[model samples]
Target: MSVLAAVVRELGSEPVVEEFADPAPEDAADVVAAALNPVDVAVLNGQIPFRRLAPPFVAGLEGVARLRDGRHRYFFAPEPPFGSFAESVPLAGAEMTAAVPAGLDPVVAAALGVSGLAAHLSLTATGGLVAGEDVLILGADGQVGRVAVQLARAFGAGRVIGVVRDGDSRRVPLALGADAAVSSTDVDGLAERLRAEAPDGVDLILDLVWGPVVGPSLAVARQNARVVQVGNSGGPDATLNAPSFRNRGVRFLPHSNFLFSPEDRAAGFEELAARAARGEVEVEVERVPLAGAPEAHRRLVAGAAKRKLVLTTTSGTD
Candidate 1:
């Protein structure tokens, strides 16, 4: 049997839709919706040192799939060569999958898998967010940042402030439940802008971009506040003044979704899914057909995809 999938013929190359041998029934699950994530791009370009895959393989890291029992679930990290972008993916049993909420849309479920889990876990587990506490989300225009804004509000944040690189992108987070949005276009004035919105300082900081902005974002951290470092989209290195953070006793925590146990990840995703179903949490997403993965990949690499992109199969739409 053969199945259609987005295959990367070589590292650093665009994915091409083509037929590939189907996985055996014992190892395969019917794919519904697959999320295109930055990690997927990293893995594709061989940028992830820990996970290096040879080319001519299916392209996607996580997605929503149908189990044999007719229940839909979100699965991640399919064994190499078999990815969620395909109609049938070789998922390794129930260990790598989580049950999706009954009423959640498949595309939403897919979007909520990787990015949702990151935002949900980083805020609650790593950042130790408390109800009525002020929260700051860096890189608020990105997928995770956008979701984090909504999750923070839904989770009972007192004030949610989002920081974007461009002034025009500030509205992206504002519409997603952030109380205020600040542009980091001028790094020198970022701290002032953040303070104007969060005069008392933020209780929890979700730092998605670690660069010059990190220093300013940290300046407004309340004493004992936790800064959860999720990504470094802005740059790989950040300069910080030791005394600034030391005097406030602010805690910096590094976060990786892979570090969470499967159970913890599932619980976080389930909670987000529940909230999304009830309209309490929402992520801006663009739905693309499975065959359009190549174009999606191009947009993702070129940084043109402003919203979360989910590859939907025919069955996924229904």
Candidate 2:
């Protein structure tokens, strides 16, 4: 059998299809890719200069594609966790598996894995989240941020405060399990107002924004609170006061290593996907056929029109 892998052979590039000797099913059965990850985006963004690491390598970073022979189909990133892309890649089946729940289409279920990984780790592992805790999810309209709203609630967060700029109530944290939701433009002194609602201060902060938006709000964290930094959506540069952290005994956890450990990735995806299969985890997709991959890539580079862009071979427009 021939394996279909996307290879990125150069710097400032995109993945091109390459064939590999599909190993005997008895050897190892792991195949599926979800989408380009933040590191892939970083490489694409030239943050660390992916080309400097290795030349003529596989460029597709993360995905939840499929694995045959009784394996779980998922959206997973390849491991090492970090790659220069590669000449030969062993797509980890664990990171790729996502449970296909009833009432949820495969594409949407496929879409949930990567987003769910980020949401799960932040709320459980790093945030040390517990039942009845209140959370402040900055830039909550983002892919992972939006899902963080739901997972936090499902994990038993008492209230979720989401910050977003999208029109319509799509960013509503309440619907996603937040007791209340707020728009970023909802009047002045937003953090103070939020503080008023939770007098003791918020327990966990899932921040997609890292700059001016969240710097000041660092004060809103309770003593021994956890602030999980998942995205640089607000720009990478920020002014952080040593006193604020020292005073609060706050903890900061980096969010980009979701694919770092396959064991952890497997456990995380399995749990999240089970929820997806049950209709608790949801994904909204703007699907494009395989032939449209090039155009879709262009749209992504130009700036995505919607949060999730899923390429699909099947049509289940339910």
Candidate closest to the true structure, highest TM-score: 1
Query: Mind giving the per-residue lDDT tens digits that candidate 1 earns over 1-318?
Result: 989999989999888999988998788888999999878888989898756888888889889998788788898878877788989987774346887888888788898788888899999899888899999999988888988998888888899999998999998998988889999999999988888888889888899999889999987899988889999989999999988998999989999988989888888888888899999888767999999999998898888987789999987766
Cα lDDT of model 2 by residue, 197-285, tens digit:
56677888898888666765675788988888887777899888888888878988777644347667767767877776676767667
Model 1 misses residue 177 by how many Å?
A: 1.5
Best by lDDT: 1
lDDT of 1 at 26: 80
Q: What is the C-alpha RMSD of each candidate to the true structure, in Å?
A: 1.5, 4.7
Clashes of 1: 0
Worst 10 residues of 1 by lDDT: 90-99
Candidate 1 local accuracy as lDDT? 0.88
